[model samples]
Target: MSRLEVYDLEHNYVTTLANAYNVGYSKEENQLWDASFQLPYDDPQLKYCRPLRFIKIYDNEDEYIGEFRIWPSEKKKSMSDRQVKIELLDCLHTLTDSVLFGYYQLNNYKTDYVFNWLLNKQKNKRWIPGRVDFQRGFSYAWENENGLVDALFSIPKPFDEDWIMERDTTVYPWKISLVKPQTEVTARIIEGYNLKEFTVKESPQKLVNRVYALGDGEGVNQLTFKTINNGKAYVEDTFSQEEYGLIEYIWTDRRFKDKASQKASTEGMLRNWKKLQYTWEITALDLMKLANRPSNLAINQGREIKANELRLGKVIELITEDNEPIQFRILKESKSDIDDGKANIQLTLGNVIGNTGTTIADVERQQEINTNYANGATNIVPYIFDREADFSNPVEFKFFVDDDVRNVNTCELTVDTSHFRATSKGNTSSPQTVSSSTSSAGGASVQSATSSAGGASVQSATSSAGGSSTQTSSANGSHRHRMFSPGDLIGPLPETRYVAYGGGFVATGSPNDIYTAEAADNHTHTVNIPAHTHNVSINIPAHTHSVSINIPAHTHQVSITIPGHTHEIIYGIFEYANLPSKLKIEVDGNIVPIDSTSFERFDVVPYLSKDEDGKATRGRHTIKITPSDLARIEVQLILRVFIQSQLGGEF
Candidate 1:
């Protein structure tokens, strides 16, 4: 026979003494300490009562260590002595708490606290199995499709994450309780009354049996609600502060399924549980209280309010104040599949933490390792495309590495097609030495194009003296002889020698006060044209010039010849000399119009005519002028004209 002792806490006021020992202890720790006194006295307390005693041990410094206690066990639980000792040791640390039991701090203490204390604080299992005594004609179905019956349960406020399903033989998946026994529900039906205005403390308990209330002409009714057959039940409980009431619930078997179902039932309860009341006093009070609060109330407000950190496929958008979906994916980070923001996410090339060929799955798995290696750095974005992309929609994504924020958008993602071609070509090029017909026999074998004969000359002559002679000679020669000389071409002069030209042509005097001299068109003049270069200066107006020749100072133009082709270079018309401007210039009878007049004055080197042996020949060059072409020139002055007159004159 086993003996026991009981300290009747509620009856003997022993809670005062128990409270003294509960100092600085958490609920778990306190439960352990409470077990030392309460465990031996469960079930038939009088039969298990005994006088319990304990010996307290103290250190040399008078600090408490622990105590040894003994009592009779009401429940003969089967466990090895070692397991019991381990349990006792765990219980012993509860007496000390973290402050005194610092050495025995459990692994993952805070996580465990969150799991056991905070997360497991509340439980709601919607499925409830209750034994029913169907009086004769009544039939009950366990898995009813339409759900003819409902099982309801209650728990305190707040919820947790660990209410998962597990197979159990004896216990129902849901938490169970008995509704307050033999409750009398008295209901009064009033016409034209606000249902929400009813109060639990003041309003008569009405419509007790059914899930909803229906009122007709009946003034009032009394309904008796009793707990059915030793199972969980719920009464018409009203929590006005929380704005909640009770409703019919569905029973389920799986604990997790019950959890979800219970939440739906509670929400339904709050929505449909209407009450009848004659006054709107509570609603008025609520209105008054709401009005007294601050104005311009807002949370997570403003437009284009980008996220501090966004994962790949994090549909960034302009949401209304009411959280309505405005548009589809505003931006795409690389390798994201989620269309909505509410999904598991990974880093992408477009996000702050760039996706570096690391797939979303890979990144998530290796996040800890990569973070450790990089010291919490966001990895570089992978090169998804050699070219840029044309991001059509606008999206702003901002993220921080510590305090440094990075932002990217369509501007950053716009693909550069040129880069892709370059890279692809480079990758495919053969490494072997290539020989092409374009390459000179004496030169390094390559196939790059050359614009002039100088490159060809040097390349061919390279086998002899490495082409140093040809390179220097060709560069200087071509530059020195670009235009034709007098001897290069023998042509008849035009019938008209000089054309009438005016407008800003200031020559020693005005147009009316000019002097003319006839030294002789009489003598048989053999004109000795010099073997010299032709150089001229002309200025263009700052604005567009008309053919009128009447425009003043700013308008200026001149002409020069190169290889029978005359190039009329213009200056001063700064506005007409932009990159896209067209030059409608004409020289002689040939019309050569340069789109722009921005060129500076430079010499057209005399063209040295080559003999059969490739040596240059030089002589005078006669330039013809025409009236129709003169209107296009903005010349200020025609300078440095050299002509020779001889005995024959026509020679």
Candidate 2:
């Protein structure tokens, strides 16, 4: 009889009981076990549908056989007794069948980290991390529609390995390992031992020499495949070509979107195909009889094995009675007993064939290619800068890059300038004229005359009134035409006549006669009358004659003329048509040339600090794009890059 211990999901111990259980596992289906027990009809603790309760089966020597999770049970009732039939499943059921309810998105997270995160979400302490050494990071998204098991299997593991769930008896929690075949064994029957039964079988239906593994392609949801062949050479002896049957498998993970991964998967399938061409079934009892002494009994030497020694995916050697040694891989195993002394163990194994020539180095190289070049850290996302930018002020643009990027030398940038014009005008002064007048006058005159002459004269004399004395007449031989002077005709001519008479008495004989006529009274009257008449006639008059002179008033005029005008100016106009001369570009605080406005696939290496050992440190990195002396015109920029990390690979 085997000792069975029961526990809850939290690993809290329940009760140890003596019972019989039949446990089995198969590659095609989930592992399961069944047991039955009787309890009192009114037992208070017995119940159904209790989740997470489990059972551990151990043999009589206190070695572990297997662990099982308990499911709901069916109860059978009699009048005095009741029996409960309980079914259990392998520990893997929690991973595969349990529903995961939440949103899960992995953004450039390593595959091992993602796996650990999923397990932690279950809130169960049973499952813990083991040998999860994958170097690549992946991006994925899922809703509540997937199980943790599906999500884990969907990731691309490095080296084309498989995940195996196992428990370390010394530790409290179960562990999962990304593993390959690491151990081998041989099963042989002693010649004088009791062997219950053994059988060897070969099935041609399982033989394959060619394989095609389908995987993710470059396009969205696209499918692609890689093919592997055993040989392409013809047989020299038979002069014929050999052909092996084809087997196809599809890897639905989107992470296998590279040629290297596809090739590695196809080769892994070819390796499996070469190993599992035949099947072997072997059953034996726990006890056997010794050949020499028929009465003496001995325990079977190779009947019972340790749990760790005979687990699934382990390789072992089996030699049959015909003395043929066959290397086989254990695909299924079962142990059963019914509370009897005898215990039976059964195994389903497959034959191991030659190697498929696929090595760990090849698989690792393929993994590196996928991680570094294809579907890895390299990225291209479209972005746009402000086309209508204010160039006068400093125009700055920003973008983000992953911390894993090794060197950011692979980048590109581009730009363009704007168009249009402006103007203004003013005025200062106007037009004018002026005039004046004057007048003056002056006059002067002079005359002179002189005369000297010889003259002939006649003389006459008259006497005034009152003197009737003598009228004198002079005659002389020498007198020439003499006229009487006023002084000479003085006083009286009579007196002259008397003196003449007296003197002439003695005088000369020449004289002759004298006449004395006196009209003195009449002459004096006439002279007075003449003076009165002349005074009467002397009367004068004053008068004015008609005269005319004409003059008039008037005006004079002056004028000036002028014309209109204007002025113009331009603003924010660029110096050059194609590229601005005064421009500077700084990326991460480093200056770059702006000779070309449009940079086609230009590369910029980001400045990353290193340790003293000259190894690059991984963290958040910054890239600042600043354009200098830009204004009024439209500016544009475009960019692209690649990222890589050394974190997980080194560990």
Please name the candidate that would achieve the greatest lDDT relative to the true structure: 2
Residue 351, model 2: lDDT of: 39
Q: Which 10 residues in a row give candidate 2 its minimum summed lDDT?
A: 232-241
| Tens-digit lDDT string for candidate 2 (212-302) | 4444323322324321223221101111114443443333333443444455555565555543345566674433212242322222354
Residue 391's lDDT within candidate 2 is 40
- What ranges in model 2 sit over 4 Å off? 18-50, 60-62, 76-83, 92-122, 127-157, 160-164, 169-182, 189-242, 245-250, 255-266, 274-276, 286-315, 321-323, 336-342, 351-651
TM per prediction: 0.14, 0.45
lDDT measured at residue 190 in model 2 versus the true structure, 0 to 100 = 32
